[model samples]
Target: MRTGNTTMRAPGALALAAVGVLVLAGCGAGGNNMTLATGSTGGTYYPLGGEIAQLWSDNIDDVNVSTQATGASVENLRLLDNGENELILAINGVAANAANGESDFADEPLANPDDVTLLGNVYPEVLQIVATEDSGIESVADLKGKRVDMGPPGSGTEVAARQLLESQGWDPESDVEAFNSTFEEATTKLSDGQVDAAVAILAVPAASIEQVATGGTDITMVEIAGEEADQLMEDNPSYSTMEIPEGTYQGQDQPVQTLTNWASLYSTSDLDEEVAHDLVQEMYEGADDIGHDVGDQLDAETATESRGPTDLHPGAERYYEEAGVLD
Candidate 1:
């Protein structure tokens, strides 16, 4: 992972070894200092977020950038609301939760949920439940009484895991012997016969899942569909249907039907409108710089579809309107 700033000040390396966290420092040459909050290292958010920060630092003058490791959507929203970070990469569903002051923010309601603004949509995040062959789990219902890794603490994965369990009429706290662990750690335990299944909602062909599948371990990617999936989407309007194409993973010859929550960039009202406009404009103009592999997910054509749950920032709206992305 790239760490430290690339401009504004001299770039220096600082690796936080606790959990694959890397902080990138850049010279705040243009006089604007801001931080970008991303997720765990193994997930898609960190890399993409790092690329975004780099683009902004390298292109936008006077904008100094710092990227921070966080617990993905939920944690990033908290940091953004608390004014710790100027920008955040978060899941649409989690962003909705934060905007409504529900779940994690029930007690500590954000002072200005209306101020949460969308920068652009990144891509769909599929909810994957991988069970070891030995666990005898065929469907989500089979998770009963089995030991499961419900993602890391304070993560969007954890929220989605619990929601899926609840939708199936199971008490996640009582029906399953639950443990909290990162996808990396959970993958190791799954291969070692320690955990029966792991609930992870991430970009397709996730590194963690690839780790287990390529290691020759017999694993099954359970599908979450039919009435249950419909109900899940209905309850959380931010969610949408998405499919994993055939051959996306080993032994997975058929497409898997699942629900997806979009990944989006967020900024609060505190950011200057003109600065926000420039940021959004540059993001589209510099799209090619983000690498083909990950950049494919950030299609500028559908960026306007990102306006859900949270309102679009005024500056971003101005740019999108002028560009004809928004009417």
Candidate 2:
């Protein structure tokens, strides 16, 4: 449906109707403009970033890519570190804490977090946490006092819901009242009871947690495995442990576990390695029109597998070293 625009400034008559759709998409004709950013308009990076910006403007030659929604992985790494986005769709643990400035870019980092690279691995995300089957939460130690939304302010679901509520010692601003919104206003404030839990970090049946598991409000999810998700993957090695299975939502039947990360595809090393190897080879040769299910986890043999702390984008490391899937 191509919807997004769930706020993050806009409104000045939709920012002059997004500057008249970037001057009828010409965006200054021959300059080969690009944008991308994405997130919110109910998650999974704005309809897979509007089908990967219309498959990189119908296959790159004179590029025009646009997309923009915003407030996703730490505001798409400060809009690709202020060059105002040339591509994004982040959350490889908030693009490795905005390239090592660490956790929510520790008080304003990234003015050039070594120009944020990487341009592949677009899947994994997970983390779910939902709640509201009367909010008895059922894990992640029952989300303390509860209200919770925790996403949207420079989200990666608010940097993994404030590091899984400071790895269970609480204090995510007074142990949960928190709201921040989006992910379709935290699934209509957790299906109208007005929040009791939310937390996202998407992909895998998360259309705002499938409208709070079929929208009649009896939701659940929670789980982040034993030993507190292995000490939150030993204190966030950009997190790991995934599962979610059991029918993947719609009152999710069993397999829960949790925590994952990898979303990927960013940009900045001032892009152009033959336009980041034709935007990672037309995003896995037009990953089946990116209709979403995380575009069946795009392939190129796992595209340099799970890249977390960035790097790679010498035009996607010369197209993953000429498609041998790089070493």
Candidate 3:
């Protein structure tokens, strides 16, 4: 468990003076407190965020970081824009939409999109389309007129699902029966025959998919390849092609081609450069503590190469340049 300062204030004048001193000291006179917004409980972001946050708090001096469980990507970006979170793990594609006031953020984009800077790319969030073997969903084209879980509202999965449906020239709202639910809920529904297929944007070998496979429901991974995937990637520059190797998940014998968006760390440009520098330094130095498969992907070279929608944070850039990773 994580510990935080919880001293209550006293009422007297002398007490107020003491509190004032404590506040100043706590606000960098002593340390800095920050919150990292991650994804739903069943997804990779929540657990991974906790490990990363703990790693930073343990290794960085005077820095106390906490992780917030969120709806993922879109919501995380909104939280960052509204100042509810100091740091966030978001899909680079969603971040681009938020920056440009497109898609989910069409009504109100980030107040200062330029100020949202990238720390580094954490991992690839592959678009995993899992369908029950009985659903008859052999391909993306077969999703028409079927029951599909499009992921939770305000999640990157939701955005990706809609975009994919659009890429096929179908209206997401009218063409399919869409259910907006968390990955856990969607998996449960899939296992119980409540939904035919579900969409997830997560690391390979996702626990939710694992549960369905082990729960006696034969599942098939729908491929997001060919001309459709190419057009999707061409239209959404933030996305790229990726492959989930054979046997990454239960019952998955062959490699599956799919679209991928990077899961990158983001923070406002106002973060202190020195603090950001130290944070990036410790992220790589203490990477082992992350305790997740994704941690293995963290390195100065890949970190510097996977840029986000906005410019890289100067502090992060400095660390990468000095480490001889940035070109």
lDDT of each: 0.78, 0.77, 0.83
Per-model tally of clashing residue pairs: 11, 0, 1
Work out the TM-score per prediction: 0.89, 0.33, 0.90
Cα lDDT for residue 324, candidate 3: 86
Candidate 1 lDDT trough over 10 residues, lowest sum: 9-18
Cα lDDT tens digits, model 2, 190-242, are 88889888888888887788877887988888888988888778888878788
The 10-residue segment with the lowest total lDDT in model 3: 1-10
Writing each residue's lDDT as its tens digit, candidate 1 over 1-327 gives: 111233663132223223333222232334566677888877777777778778877887666566777888887887777766778888888888888888767887787788788877777778888899778887877898999999878788998998888877889899999988977789899999999999998888787898898898888888888887887877777777878788787777788888887778899877788778877777777778886256767666777574666888888889888887788
Error of 3 at 148 (Å): 0.7
Which number leads on lDDT?
Answer: 3
Runs in model 3 deviating more than 4 A are 1-28, 306-309
RMSD score of candidate 1 (Å): 4.7
lDDT of 3 by residue, 1-327 (tens): 122223322132234334553221135554666778899998999999888877877766677677777899999988887766778999988988887789888887778787788888888889999999999998999999999999988999999999999988999999999999999999999999999999999987788998999999999999999998988987788888899999988899999999888888989887888778877887776787777878887776777454645889999999888888886
